[model samples]
Target chain A: MKPARAAWLFLAPALLVLGVFFLLPVLGALGLSFTDYDLYALADLHRLRFVALGNYWALLHRPAFWAALGHTFYFVAVGVPLSLAASLGAALLLASPLARCRAFFRTALFAPVVTTAVAMAVVWRYLFNTQYGWANHVLGAIGIHPVDWLGDPHWAMPTIILFAVWKNFGYNMIILLAGLQAIPRELYEAARLDGASAWRQFRHISLPLLGPTLLMVTILTVSGYFQLFAEPYVMTEGGPLESTTSVLYLMYEDGFKWWNLGTAAAEAFLLFLVMFAATLALLRWPRRSGA
Target chain B: MMPRLARALVNGLLLGGALVALFPLAWMLAVSCMPPGTANTLPPPLWPAHPTLDNYRQLFAHAGMWRYLGNSFLISGAITLLSLTCNLLAGYAFAKLRFAGRERLFRSLLGLLVVPAQVAMLPLFLLFKYTGLVDSYAGVVLPGAATVLGIFLVRQYAQGLPDALLEAARIDGASELRIFTTIVLPLLRPVIATLAILTFLAAWNDFMWPLIELTGQDHYTLPLGLAAMAREHTAGTESLMAGSVLTVLPVLLLFLSMQKYYLEGLLLGGVKG
Candidate 1:
């Protein structure tokens, strides 16, 4: 056989799988969004109505959708900064001149990143138990009252956020460490010669130098944070009266639990649009402001 | 000037941070061995006073953990093997084959990377639902069989192989499949190992898809099993910890053994860059 014919044969199986399974469903989702497909529509196609923009409109005006969106935004607003600060702090400490057992500490901090989220969340659920939880035990040591973490609506989302920060910050910590290492030692030396204090030197030499790395980390974190599902699902089940219901969590419940396929597809697309816009804004803001 | 006592305090703070980070996992193991009500005591013992394997025995006996363990192994192992075969072949073809539309197709696949896997997940569920593949292994397995990133990783690795060797094989009337299996397969061992470990871990830890697809408890994987077990109101702390231990141990060991490949794949995935 000619190599051209042979090559197509080689590519056929994978390409077919990707085209049918991946590309088709993505387009199917776009098509499904235009219809009024729901649990009834699942049983029969005749029940499905072609309702363009109706789902989007309902999502905008509906209190539940707005509440889910608000919950997602609340998560992003609180979770991202805490994660970034923890990562940057770990990276800074690891990059310190007097730091010893550098490799060991690096490994220790990153141990959580490789953990299966499902398993860790299981572990965390126990750790946040209202009565026997170690978190409360530690609080007890400090003479503080035990807080119902995953149980109370007010505390549930924040608890998930804490678990997320612990799970993820290490991954970015490594990236930021690499970013720190790439900065020339001479810049620190130069700053020292000018008698710059530690904080000022960090502001001038470290932050300025890490602009690109910081941007990438923030974008990746924001995207990851916005897709929050597994954390809330196994942790709180969008719980304490849906206070922890993220957009993806809402999408999951609407799509799978309720079988509202059309609305769920809209949720998925809206999430995609939001994330896409967030990334673009992140990339644009730094450049426009000349950060 | 800072005194020696001040320096000691800083080190103490760092040590405390490390301990706090690790204590949950450490305590999980400790509580798993404790007797039924031991961990729930007022003062909360640091070590189990009456350490026993009774909770583990109970988890395996009543909760059917072994079934979930088997489900996890079967799904993850199958995904790893399938991903290796499909990705390797497609990657090699993209790297070495002379075909029309190859670059365009591959480029488009790369474009799909920006769209999070979650975007397709919602629709994919409906697609599976219509096929009656929902609540089946096929449902859990089909969508992930050939990933764009997996193909891209293999292609990038395969691009560097010398053409002269393949040319000689072709001249000898060696079929492309023969060249792939007999020659390229052995050369691509390192990446295959890397991707296999990575894929297996990913499949094993996979939450959203398997949880969505496997509606019945009989088909639940370890993660799913553990999640359900954690929510059982009557479940003792010991049994839950045992479940956590069972779920986490495999991936933890895999990661520790092959940190290099995991990190390499991480950097390649654009998450690190």
Candidate 2:
């Protein structure tokens, strides 16, 4: 066979899988979104009705969809910064000259990133258990009363946020640590010669140099945080009156549990648009501000 | 004196952070070993007084954890093998082959990355149901058999291989298939290891899709099984921890052993792409 034909032969298997499974279904979801494809329609194609943009409009009016959106925003808004701060803080410490056994600490911190979310969430559920859990036990010892972490609606999302940060921060920690190592030692030495304090040196030298890495990390973390499903599903079950119900969790329920494929497709698209817009805003902000 | 104090403070903070990071996992192991109902006691014993295998025994014999473990291993192993083969072929072709639409096709693949996998999942379920694949191993494994990231990673690595090597092979009258299997496969060992571990860990830890696709208890992966168990046995803290340990231990060990390649793949996927 010619090289071109050979190449096509090589590509055929992957293309077939990706095309049939990924691309085709993505297009199908778009078509499904325009129709009322619930359980009845799922059972009988004759029951399906064409409704252009109706799914989107119906989701817009639904309280659960809006509430899930608010919760997702709440997650991204709070979880991103907190996760970044934790990651940056840990990376800074590990990068410090005085830090000992850097590899051990790095691995320990990154361990959570490798474990299954459902498994760890299960452990976390017990750790934050109301009466017998370690979290409240420690809090009670410190003269603070035991607060319900996953039980109360007001506290459930926050608890999930905490779990998410713990679960994810280490990943960015590794990336930030790599960025930290790439900074020149000479720069730090020159700053020290100029009598620049550690904090000032970090602000002027480290932060400015690490800007690109930080931006990439932020974008990746933001997108990942938006897909907040397993944590709530495993830990809170969108509990205490749907406080932890994320947009993805709502989609899973609508699409899988309730078989409301049309509305679920709309939910997925809205999430995609939101994430796309957020990523675009992040990319454009730097250029627009001339930073 | 001030430097000494600062050093101590930094060490203290690092130690504290490590403790926080590891305490939950350590506690899981501890509770898993403890006798039943011991975790619910006042003060919640940090270590088992007399560690026993009863909970683990209970997990395997009573909770049907072994079935889920077998399912997880089979599904993840199959995905890793099939995905690696498919991705390697396509990645190598995209890198070195003379083909029309290679660049355009690759760019389009990259574009598809932005459309989250969840977008395809709903319709994919209906498609699977129509094809009689829902609740089958094929349903879980086939969709994951070729990921954009897998192809991208392999292509990135394959692009680094010398063109002259392949050219020499072609001049020697070797077919592309022979060249790929004998020369390219061996050359791509490092990346193959990385991709295999990444895919295995991902498939093992995956929850949502398996939870959706594998509806029956018999077909459930470990995560799905554990989630189901968690719902039914909410108050059985010790038994739940045992289940959690079983679900997490294999992947944790795999990650720990191959962390170098695993971290390399992470940076490769994140930084370059």
Candidate 3:
């Protein structure tokens, strides 16, 4: 057999697997988004109607869709920066000369990266329990009233946010540490010699050098935060009133729970559009700023 | 003089950060050891007055955690094996094979990484439900078989393979698959190990897809089982910690043992991919 033919055979298996499993499903989702195909439609394709963008239109008008979008945006808007700040702080600390037990600290901080999110959420859920939780017990010691962490709608998302930051800040911290290491030491030395304060040195030297890494981390974290399913699924089950119903959670509910496959497909596409556009915007903004 | 004060303050901050980072995990261990309801007091006890393994016994006895652990092991193991084979072959082939449309195909596959796996997931569930794979191990294992990241990693390593060796093998009348198994697989050992750890870690940590697909509690993996136990015992603190411990231990061990390879994979996936 010719080597070219053999090579084709070798590649064929993987391509076929991806084609049938990945590509077809992705395309199917796109088609499903346009039709009013659902569980009822699943029972018989004859029930399916070609509705064009009617699913998207209905999703826009649906209050649930807006609430899901708000929850997701709230998650991304608040969660991303808070996570980045915690990551940046941890990374900066790890990068600092004065920080002792650097190895121990880095490992401890990054420990959550390997943890199952379902398990992490479970641990956090117990930790936030109003009666049995240590969070309230500690507050009680400080003479503060026991705040219902997961029971209150206003506090539920914040608790989830805090849980997410604790679980994930370490992943970005490691990446940022690498980014910090790549920044030339001579730049910091020059700043220090010029009598720049530590904060000033950070602003001028560190932040500018970290621009690309910052952008990359933000894009990754934003897109990651967009698929906020497991946290809410485990901790809130989409809420104390759907306060934590992320786009992915809503998609899961509409698709799996309600069997509204068509509407769920539309929701998934809308989420994809938002994430794709957001990522592109972030990627382009830096180049534009540089220009 | 100023630097000394700054150093002291920084030391204090470092100490505070370490406690914050490590406290929850430490507290988890402590609380698991405490008797039920003992840790739920006005001032939370730092150490359990009477440490016990009763929670673990309870987990194994009634909570059915052992079955979930078995599921986690079996599913993750199957995924790791298949992912290594498929990803290594495809990754290596993409890196060095003389195939038509190789670059374009690989590029498109890589581009799919952007469309969050969650996006296709809604329809993917319906797709699986039709196939009778839902509520079965195949549902969890099939989609994980071939991954873009796995292919990318192997390709990066495989691009470094010597062309002359493959040519010599071909001259000896060896088929492509034979050469790959004997010559290429040996050379790709480092990447295979790295990819194995990564694939296993991901499979073990997977939550959403399995949660949706594994409708039967009988098939719950560690994460799913943990979630179920948490819901079942919403007020049971000590038992929940034990459940968390069971869920996290395998991953923690794998990570600690193979930190170098995993860290290398992380930086490689980040900077290069």
Candidate 4:
């Protein structure tokens, strides 16, 4: 057989799966977004009516949709920076020559990333419990009030953000550690010869060199943080006056729970556009600054 | 003297961070073993004074956790094996084969990466429902069988294989299948290990898709089952902790045993892709 034919044969199963399951559904979702598809329509095809852009328009007027978007943006805005900082701090510590038990620390830091999120979120619910949680216990020890971490609307998103950071920072830490290791030791030595303090060396040499990795990690984290669902689903169930309801959680509820497939598909698309713009803006910022 | 002080500060910070990171998991285990209701006491105990297996026994016996555990194992295990095979073949072909539209197709796959998986989910569910796959193992397994990231990782690793190896095999009149199975596969073992671990951990820990797809109680994976249990058993702290342990322990142990491959795959997918 010809090599091309053989290649097609090799690609057949994977391509089939991707086309049928992933690619087709994506196009189908786009098409579905233009119509009024719901549980009734699902049961009877004739009930489906083409409402070109109606779902998107309805979402624009819906308060819950806007609130969900705001919550999702809050998560991304707050969670991304906290996650990156924690990751970078841990990575810096692990990378330091002064640090001992490097492997142990690295493994311990990364352990949370591999655990089941739903299960860990359950653990966090208990940890942040108002009356009986360790969080309140620690706060009381510090002469602080025992705040309702997951129950109060004002604090629920922040609590979830804290959980998100703890659960995810290790992933970026490993990547950034790899980036840190790749920088030449000579650069740091040269800076020291110039009497540069450690802070100056990091600012001038380390940060500049780690720019691309930092930006890439930022983009990945931003996008990942935007899809905040399982955390809120398991921890708060979008509770405390819906303070923790993320955009994806909203989409889940609208599409699955309420059987509003068209509206959910529209929400998904609107989110895609937002993510695309955010990533594009992120990519362009570094270039615009002549980095 | 300054260096010594700095070293002390750095080590102290590292120790503190490790404690923060590992504390929740450790607490989960401690609370799981505690006699029921003991964890709700004042000054939450770090260790169970009177440890027992009652929670675990109750979890398996009363809560139907054993069935969910079985479901999780079956779903994650099947997804791992099937996805590994799909990714390996496609990755190798993209890396080595002389094919029409190869680069274009690969670029298209990369483009698909930016569209979040959630977008496809709504219609995907409808499609599955139409096909009678909803609330079934196939519904969960099929969508996750081959991911763009998995294929990208394999292709990156496969690109490093020398052309001379494939050329020599071809010169010997080895069929493409023969060459792939005999020559390419053995060389791809490192990546295969990496992909297997990554895929298994992902499938085992996955909650969103399973939650949406598996509608029936009888078909729920561990995460789905545990989430449902949390809703109903909100006050059952010991039992919930035990259930969390059961849900997280398998993947945690798998990751610990294979940290090398898992980390390598993380860097490979993130840095390269």
Candidate 5:
């Protein structure tokens, strides 16, 4: 049999699945977003009005949409940097020669990455409880007042951010650890021969070589941080005056709960647009700065 | 002496980080074993006053958690098996076969990664609804059954296979399917392990798609059930913690057992890709 023909046969099933289930629905979303496809449209095709861009237009005017967008951006802007720093810090520590019980520490750090987000979020909610949580308990011991973690709008997002950092930093830590390991020990030795300090060696030798890996990790982490749904959903239910309401959480409510399919599709597309632009900017920034 | 101080500082920070990472999970375990309302007390007890299985009993007996557990296992297992086959075949073909437009097709698929899955989700839900798959396991499993990342992972690993070996097998008048099953499959064991672990873990921990698709209580996965249970009974702290323990334990154990393959897949998918 022809290899090409056999290849086509092998590819057929997966391509069919991807096309029908994933790619086609993406196009379908674009179509849905142009109209007011809602619970009314679901019952009868006659009610489906083709109001081109109307959904997007209304979303632009909706203050709730703006607020959700604001909260999501806040999460990405703050969460991404904090997450990266923590991951890099942990990776550096683990990569140190003096570190002991390396395997146990590595697994322990990475454990939270595997646990179900909803389950961990539940645990986190209990831990941050104003009355009974360990967080306030530790604070009280330090002579600080117990703060309402999930109930106060100002504190809710920060608490969620902390949870996000703890849950996620390990994943990137593993990647960055691999990155650090890949850098040759000879370079550091050479730097030391030139009387370079540890910080200077990291600044000059390690940082430059780890640039590509760092950028890649940052891009992946940034895109993932944008899709902040399950945390807000399980932890606060987008409560505390909706301070933790991410764009994806809003999309879930608008599309799934209210059956505002058109508006939700529009919101989904806008999110895609923002994420795409962000990724492109990340890709271009290093090049533009002549790095 | 100076180096000793630095070493101590580094190890101390690592110990602190690991403690922070593992504390919540440990607390969840401790809280789940506490008697009802024990966890809600002041200065939250680190250890239960009297450890008991009451919360687990309530979870299984009253909350009907067993059903959701079964559902999660069934769906995740099916997805892992199904998607592994799909991704393996396609990935091997792209790497080794002489198909027209193979590179272009693979590149286009990679390009699709930039478009968030949520963009397709609303319409995908509608499509599933129209096809009567909304509440079924198929709706949850089918979309996930063949992923671009899975294919990419497999293809990257498969590209290293010696073409001479494949050629020799083909010269022996072996059928393509036979060559794949008998010759390629064994050699692809490492990647197969990686992809299977990745897929099963993702499926088990998946929340959003299942949350949307599985509308009925009977079809609910563990994450969905936990979320619903969390919302409905916020006061049932002990049982909720028990439910969370059940939901997290399987995948946590799987990950611990297969850390090497899982971490390898992450680097492959994230850094290399």
Candidate 6:
């Protein structure tokens, strides 16, 4: 058989799956976003009608969309930095010469990443309960007043962010550990020989070399934080006045719960645009600063 | 060359971090073994007063967790086996084969990575509904069988295969399929294991797509069933914790056993790819 034909044969199955399931539906979403495809239309195709930008217009005017967007941004802005710091700190300790039982610590740290998010979220909800939670119990032992971790509107998002960080930081820790391990030990040796302190060596040698990996992890984490759904869905049910209602959660309610396909498709596209632009900006920011 | 005091400080901090990471999981297990209402007290118990298998028994008996567990295994196992095959072929083809428009096609697929899976989900649900695949395992499993990330991961590993090996196979009068099966598959074992574990875990833990696609209670996966159990005000905290434990343990054990390849795949997919 011809090499090209054989190659195509190898590619055909996956390509068909992607084309039919992924590519076709993405195009269908674009079409759906321009129309009024609600429960009525879902019941019968005859009720479908094109509304051309009307869904986007309505979303722009809807306060819930804006609120959900704000909540999502809040999650990304706060969660990304916190998660990155936790991951970096853990990686640094593991990479340190002073640390013992490195393998055990690494596995223990990474164990959370492998657990189901919904399951962990449920566990966390119990752990953070205002009355019976261990979090408040520890605080009480320290002579601090109990704070409503999940019951308060203002605290719900923050608690979920904490859970998100604890659940996710180890994943990035593994990647960042790889990045740290890749840097030449000779570079650190030379720096120490030059009488550079640990902080100075890290700021100079480790930071610069780990830049690309850090940027990639940041982009991935930011996009991931933006799609915050399951945590809030399980922990708070997007409640205490919907403080934890993420954009994806809103999209789920609109598309699945209410059968508002047009609005949900528009919500999804808007989110994709935002995520794309955010990652693009992250990719370009360092280049501009260096230049 | 560091002082002993500073070394102790660093190790102590690491110990603290590990505790923070493992505490909730530990608490989940402990609470799952406790009797009902034991956890709803003024101070939560760190260990079960009397460890019992009653919660697990209740989950299997009353909550129908057995069904969900079977469902999860069936769906995740099918997805892992199917997607591994799809990704292996496509990734190998892209790496070693001489094909038309290979680079362009691969680039476009990478570009599609930026679009969130949620964008396609709305329409995909409609597609599944119209095609009568909704509430079926196929609806949940098929769409996940050919992810771009999986292909990218396999392709990255496959690119390291020596071209001379493939050329020699061809010159020896071996068909492409025969060469792939005999020579390539053996070499690709590491990557195949990595991709299989990743796909299985993702499918097992997946919630959103299953929630949307599988509307019936009978078709529910573990995460979906656990979510429903948590939402209902009637379910006991002990049973819920047991459900969470049951849902998480298999993948956790899988990861612990195969962490070397899993971590290798992470760096390969995240840092390099």
Off by over 4 Å in 3: A1-3, A141-143, B164-174, B233-235
Colliding residue pairs in candidate 6 = none
Assess each prediction's global lDDT (C-alpha) against the native.
0.85, 0.92, 0.85, 0.93, 0.93, 0.93
Error of 2 at B195 (Å): 0.8
The runs of at least 3 residues in candidate 4 whose Cα sits more than 4 Å from the true structure, single-residue gaps closed, are none
Cα-based lDDT at residue A199, candidate 1: 87
Residues B34-120, model 1: lDDT tens digits: 998787887767799888999889888888988999999988888888777788888899999998888897888788877877777
Chain A TM-scores, all candidates?
0.94, 0.98, 0.94, 0.99, 0.99, 0.99
Candidate with the larger TM-score of 2 and 5: 5
What DockQ does each candidate score versus the true complex, computed on alpha carbons? 0.55, 0.82, 0.61, 0.87, 0.88, 0.87
Model 6 is docked with a DockQ of 0.87
Worst 10 residues of 2 chain A by lDDT: A282-291
- Candidate 1 local lDDT, A127-148, one digit each (tens): 8889877789889989999999
Tens digit of per-residue lDDT, candidate 5, span A92-116 = 9999899999999999999999999
* Candidate achieving the largest DockQ: 5
Task: State the displacement of the C-alpha of residue A81, model 6, in Å, after optimal TM-score superposition.
Answer: 0.2
- Give candidate 5's whole-model lDDT: 0.93
iRMSD per prediction, in order: 2.5, 1.1, 2.0, 0.8, 0.8, 0.8
**Runs in model 6 with CA error above 4 Å?**
none
Model 1 stretches with alpha carbons more than 4 Å out: A1-3, A184-201, B1-14, B164-173, B271-273
Candidate 1 to truth, TM? 0.93
- Per-model TM-score versus the true fold: 0.93, 0.98, 0.94, 0.99, 0.99, 0.99
Docking class of 3: medium
lDDT (Cα, tens digit) per residue for candidate 3, span B124-170: 77788787788999888888888888888999889999999998998
Please tell me what DockQ candidate 5 reaches: 0.88
Tens digits of lDDT, candidate 4, A1-291: 778999999888888889999999999999999999999999999999999999999999999999999999999999999999999999989988899999999999999999999999999999999999999999999999999998899999999999999999999999999999999999999999999998998899888998999999999999898889999998999988999998899999999999999999999999999999999999899989998
> Which digits, one per residue and each the tens of the lDDT, describe model 2 over residues A178-285?
999999999999999999998998999889888899999999899899999999998988887999999999999998889899999999999999999999998887
